[model samples]
Target: MLTDPTMWRPAGEMHRCLTDGGSAFTEIFGTPFFDHFARDAETAAVFHDGMAAMSEPENEPIAEAYDFPPTGTVVDVGGGHGGLLVEVLRRRPGLHGSSATRRTS
Candidate 1:
């Protein structure tokens, strides 16, 4: 869905997320974008996967270069699907982690 131009072209036309009623996502979806993404199982999966895929590459350099402390818990704030956390944990076996992201029921 994200790959489709039809889905997002309207945002440019609509001036999204810039003015008071400016959220094109909210306007189009009739809900907060994240909430709308989470409303369906398949869509939520695609959303998280896309987010993880987009973010994972950016996280690799940080994970590789960072010199973690010998012991303690690492928190991956907004760590969608734990990809970055997994990489960090794989690199530092002694470290533990917590991932925080949206909760869906």
Candidate 2:
């Protein structure tokens, strides 16, 4: 299993193999997973849809509990695609919206 990276290894065996090696499955898969999903349009869309559905309603309670000033520009830093910001704007229409992400070279 360790020698062959792509072979169909069972989950239990894979878990044991990685755990015994002191390397997490995430350690092996994280970079490639993010690289592929982040760059691929279809993958990114699927991921966003999943995340959006998860964010809604589950976040509403927390959103309702918080208080924001009636008017001001709220800059959401490193806000990925602005899902949370959209929710906040939807709840509080008076607040101005601004999102900033680190520019990728």
Q: lDDT of each structure?
A: 0.74, 0.60
TM-score of each: 0.76, 0.54
Summed backbone clashes in each candidate are: 1, 0
Question: Which TM-score value belongs to model 2?
Answer: 0.54
Maximum-lDDT candidate: 1
lDDT of 2 by residue, 7-101 (tens): 23233356666567642434554544345455555755565566567666555676567797778877877565677777778789999889994
| Regions of candidate 2 where Cα sits further than 4 Å from its true position | 1-34, 77-81, 101-105
Tally clashes: model 1. 1
C-alpha-based local distance difference test score of model 2: 0.60
**Candidate 2 displacement at residue 84 in angstroms:** 2.8
- 29, model 2: CA deviation in Å? 5.1
